[model samples]
Target: MIAVNGRDTEWREGLTIRIIMQENKYTSPRIVIKVNGHVVRQEQWESYAVQDGDDVLVLHLIAGG
Candidate 1:
């Protein structure tokens, strides 16, 4: 199992940052993702693997004018 935004989720064999984002419906382009407290770059999302029991945090930045 993996923890995403403090919620438990089933761990998958081929789980990646991109997959997690899609699963959680994080469609915002201005967002940051962290795995185990480490930031995952946008370009590395596809290659960044999410392991079992990992803690993932997705935060979107909102702008106000």
Candidate 2:
């Protein structure tokens, strides 16, 4: 199982942060992603593998006046 946005989901094999973002229709890297309380570096997104029971957090940034 994987926790995404506070929701637990079934774990899918061969999953990566980039793939997750793509699957979720997130096209920008401006947002931050934290896995298991640790921030995942942008460069490592493709290499950062996600497994069962992993907690993934996707935080979107907004700029306002």
Candidate 3:
């Protein structure tokens, strides 16, 4: 299993960052994602694989000043 936003989530084989967002319905225009304490670039999300026992942090950004 993997930890997403501090909550335990099921870990599945062939899981990617893109899948995680879709599963959680995270579609914020601006956001950040961190895996295992390392930042995962937006361009790499589609191919970035998430493994079991991994810590994933998805933060939705609020923009407008």
Q: Where does candidate 1 clash, by residue pair?
A: none
What is the lDDT ranking, best to worst? 3, 1, 2
Find the number of clashing residue pairs for candidate 3. Answer: 0
Off by over 4 Å in 3: none
* Alpha-carbon lDDT, every model: 0.91, 0.89, 0.93
Candidate 1 lDDT, 1-65, residue by residue in tens: 99989999999899999998888888888989999999998999998989999999888899998
Q: Write one digit per residue (lDDT tens) for candidate 2, span 4-40.
A: 8988777788999998898889887589999999999
Q: Candidate 3, after superposition: displacement of residue 56 in Å?
A: 0.4
Clashes of each: 0, 1, 0
lDDT, candidate 3, equals 0.93
In terms of lDDT, the best-performing candidate is 3
